[model samples]
Target: MTAVFDTFYADDTLVDHLTKSIQYSIQSGGKRIRPLFLLETLQAFGIPISEAHFKVAAAVELIHTSSLIHDDLPAMDNDDFRRGQLTNHKVYGEAQAILAGDALLLDPYLLLSSADLNASVIVALVAELAYASGSHGMVAGQVLDMDGEQHTLTVDQLKKIHALKTGRMLTFPFVAAGIIAEQDDEIVALLRQLGEAVGQAFQIRDDILDVTATFEEIGKTPGKDVVADKSTYVKLLGLDGAKQALTEYLDIASQMLTEIEHKTQLQGEPILKQIERLRID
Candidate 1:
């Protein structure tokens, strides 16, 4: 994944400082959960991991990184640090940071198009990624999140917000894997369902961590959601309730994996292991 990013920015045509700023943000530490989930899903589908698969995973990570860069800007979370380092805006100035984010966000399409895959598969990945990260998906969720800061949000409302924001991006990896593997529509649908369950579980765990984890534990400022009065699973549900919600989502994910395996006779243990790793305990 790092090699993919390094090679992408190695071109001499890009401006020096702009390229440096973008590289700095991409190179900064992150869990790389999106790409990891993606690659794992492909493996579960019995697809041999190759450079083309890596490119698709890299595209997903690029989008995630762009979202993080923008989310930490002054107009958003206004954080000074991310991943225990200065936020992109803090290090590169807001203008350059915005440009860096824009590049990351837009470059994924180019990366996807260039991947060594069938045109139809590449098209599916591109469309799914765009919708997942665009207005009806992540952006819509971000709007709901900001609005929720102004007033209390019900549990259902909070779920809807996250379903679009966090869930869509997380869900894309499974869908992309199915596409790359040329699975039947039924199997692809099951993968999407599994992805959604994992996505929701991931968000619930994050909400729990925001309240409980230390700066070192989370690699960022702790309690920012609480400070901003943002609606979260923990805010709507009590701590125990939030944990229960997390468990329920994980169970759903597990069930989906079972269903997929039963239908396809393919082992889903790799994806299940990735899902289990999200559990705090």
Candidate 2:
């Protein structure tokens, strides 16, 4: 993945700073959960790991990293650190960071289009990525989050926010795998449900960590949710309650994976195992 990112640029002289910024953001340490989900989904379908798979995974990572860059800007979370290192805006100037993020966001389409796959597959992937990352998805969640700040949000409101902001991107991997495999609509729908459960669990865990974990443990500033007065599961439910919610979501995700495995008779336990890694207790 690092090698793929490092060599992704062309005509470096004209866009050296942009190239470096993008590389720096991608190289920053992360769990690479999105790409892993995509790969694992493909593996569940018994699809062999191929260059096309790598390309798709890398594109997913690119989109995720791009969102992180923008999310750390002064207008957003306004954080100084991410992934245990200085945020991109802190290292590069804010303008450069913004441009780097923009480049990252747009470059994934190019990567997908250039992949060695059928035109229809490429089109489906591109459309899914766009909807997941665009105004209708993660971006919408961000807007709602910003708006909900300082104001208390109901459980339904909070879930709706996260379903867009975080859930949509997470759903991309499973849905994309189904598309690539040419699975029927029913199978793709099941995958989306599983991904949404995982995504919600993931975000709830993040909220828990914000209140419980230290900076070193989380790799970013902890307690920002409180400081920002943002609505969160931890803030709405008590810490114990939030933990319980996490467990429930994890169970839902696991059960969804189990059903998919039984229905398709596919090796989905690996994906279930990945979801288990998110458990806080």
Candidate 3:
């Protein structure tokens, strides 16, 4: 994956300074869970991972990185550190950071278009990704989150926010896996459900960590959710309640994996393992 990124940025056509800034953000360590999920889904579907698969996975990571960069800006979370390093806006200046985020967002389409896949497959990947990342998905969710900050929200409303913001991107991997594996709509729908369950669980865990984790554990300032007066599972439900919710979501995810395998006869162990790893305790 890093090799793919290195090769893409190695092109001399890109501006040196801009590329460097983008690289700095990308190279900053992250859990890389999104791409790993995509790969695991593909593997679970009996699709052999290839360079083409890596290209698609990298595109997902690029979009995620872009979101993180923008999420850290003064207008957003306004954080100084991510993954235990100064944020792009803090290190490269706000203007450059914005540009860097924009580039990361835009580059994914180029990566997808150039991937070694059929024209129809490429088109499908592009369209779904655009939807997942655009107004109907993450952006709309972000708007809801920012708006929710001003008012206490119901648990359902909070789930609605994250189902788009975080879940759509996570769900895209399953979509891509289904498409690549040539699965039918039924299987695709099942995978989407599984991904959404995992995404919600992941967000709940994040909310739990915000209060329970230290800076070294989370690689950023903790308790920002409380400081910002944001609605989170931990705030709405107590910490114990949030944890219970995480377990419930993960159970739903496990069931989805079971259904997927029963229907497709494909091994879902890889994805099941991922769900198990999400457990905090």
Candidate 4:
């Protein structure tokens, strides 16, 4: 991935500066969970890892990085730090940061379009990615989250927010893999459910960490939810109740994975192990 970004641009000074900003954003270490999820889903289907798969994975990361850059803007979360480093807008000017994010978001479509895969597969991937990242998905979640600030949110409302904001993107890898591997609609539906469950658990853990983990421990500003007065599992459920919710989502995710494994008779241990690591306790 670093190599891809290294040669992502040419020698013009202005272009070089812009590319550098994008590179800096990508080079900053993250969990890389989204791409890993895609790869693992492919592996479970016994699909050979190919350059196309890597391209798809890179596309996913680019979209995620773009979101982070935008999310940290002064108009948004206004976060000054991410992944234990200064936020992009803090390092680069806000205009550059915004453009960089916009560039990153659009580049993925170019990648997917040019990938050496069947037209059908590429089309399916593009459609799913657009829906996941667009208004009905992550954007919707962010709007709801922003709107819910300074006001208490019901449990169902909170779940709906996370489900759109976090869960849709998390679920993309699995659904994309199923599309590439030509899985049936029933299997694809199951993968979507599993993705939703895992996404909910993932967000709950994030809420728990906000209250319980330190900045150094979590690699981002801690307790910002409270400071921002954003509605989160911790704010609504308390620490113990939020934790209980995490367990329930994890259990649901695990059960769905087991069902997928049994139905497909595939070795799902790799993905299952990843879910196990999400346990808050």
Per-prediction TM-score to the true structure, in the order listed: 0.98, 0.98, 0.98, 0.97
Each prediction's whole-model lDDT (CA)? 0.89, 0.91, 0.91, 0.89
- Separate clash counts for every candidate: 0, 0, 0, 0
lDDT of 3 by residue, 1-281 (tens): 99889988999988999999999989999999888988888887777899999999999999999999998998988899999999999989999999999999999999888889999889999998998898988888888988888589999999999998898998898888888888888998898898899889988999999999999999999999998899999999999999999999999999998988888867988778878988988
For every candidate in turn, the CA RMSD to the true structure comes to 0.9, 1.1, 0.9, 1.4
Candidate 4 per-residue lDDT over residues 1-281, each given as its tens digit: 55555544543654877888988889999999999989989998999888788888888889889999999999998899999999999999999999999998888998898778999999999999988888978888989999999999899999999989999999999899889889999999999999999999999999999899998988788988899999899888789999999999999998999998888855689999899889988
Candidate 3 has an lDDT of 0.91
lDDT string for model 1 (113-147, tens) is: 88999999999899999989999798888888888
Which residues of candidate 3, in runs, are more than 4 Å off?
none
> lDDT value for candidate 1?
0.89
> What stretches of model 1 exceed 4 Å from their correct place?
none
Model 1 scores worst on lDDT over the 10 consecutive residues at 265-274
Supply the TM-score for candidate 3: 0.98
Worst 10 residues of 2 by lDDT: 5-14
